[model samples]
Target: MIYQQFQRSPMQTRISGPRAWLAMAISLSLICLSLFLLPFVLLFGAITLGCLVLFSRVYMARQIAKLNQAQANAHQHDHTTEEPHSHVYNSVNIVRESNAKETHRMRQQGRTFEHKEDEH
Candidate 1:
């Protein structure tokens, strides 16, 4: 197998040598060019982002304005049909009373005690 491989071709290697060199040269040149243009690329990217943000903000503001205008128009049209305003009054009253009483009756061997508590 080794001998068969060795017998195949020096011609293919000779042709591939220039092709590989050309490919390497092209790759290196592109890498250098991109490095040189990096700052410009970043500046344009920032400008694009700023424009997008500005456009979005303006669009949102216009949308909000339209919504507010629509609401105002609807409110105006509904004003006549809407119910009249009504006022409500609420009142609360609280009363509290407390009483404590105790009585002791009995004599001699023991005493009897009575206690009472009431609230209203």
Candidate 2:
């Protein structure tokens, strides 16, 4: 009696007819479809990544170009606002100061005569 109570009743057993076959067919079809589409799915994923990288590079280039244009415009604007200035700020009069020590040293060295007379 105790073992009988523990045993599953036939009424509670799984139904195994068309329902089981339908479930198995659906699962098999899903597996087959996924297998068939796997390559396409991978290819599409790679293409999408490539497109994203290409678009990002193009976008970055465009942004850099825009930034360069803005900098150029800003420089031109700033240049226009500034007054025109002369290239020479102040004329410097370079007066050579003769050092007494340098003059004495030159006098001591006398005249260096290394003149080679032209042989006529």
Candidate 3:
């Protein structure tokens, strides 16, 4: 409906004289230039893509290193500030309880044991 409202009739259309020639010439020149520069354009695009990949890899590596350093600092700070014996005991207990629960659940689901020995 909107397109029909805005559409111009064929009688209103006009392409004549120097303006049409200029438009055709510009388009032809662009086509010729693009054809001539196709190889160069592709090479430049590949180089740009490679550079971007290298830059992203370096940036991600730096970010990961910073995260690891921060995690290490936090871990070190926690150990230094807390009572080690209690923390260690609590962590061990938590791990044991979680392992026990997982084992029990797997047993209930009939997936507890793996066949280690070769069957004849």
lDDT winner: 3
Candidate 1 per-residue C-alpha lDDT over 66-108 given as tens digits, one digit per residue, 9 for 90 to 100: 9999999986876756667742222211212132121111222
- Give the Cα error of residue 21 in candidate 2, in Å: 1.1
lDDT of 1 at 75: 66
Return the TM-score for each candidate structure: 0.52, 0.57, 0.52
Q: Lowest summed lDDT over 10 consecutive residues: which window, candidate 1?
A: 99-108
Per-residue lDDT over 1-120 for candidate 3, one digit per residue giving the tens place of the 0 to 100 score = 779846877544566678887998999999999999999999999999999999999999999999999999987997888884664545434443457878667656876456677863
Q: Indicate which candidate wins on TM-score.
A: 2
Q: What does candidate 3 score on TM?
A: 0.52
Q: Which stretches of candidate 3 lie over 4 Å from their true place?
A: 1-29, 88-120
lDDT at 54 for candidate 2? 100
Summing lDDT over every window of 10 consecutive residues in candidate 3, give the lowest-scoring window. Answer: 88-97
Error of 2 at 10 (Å): 7.8
lDDT by residue (58-118, candidate 2, tens digit) is 9999999999999999879867776777232322322233665655565669746475788
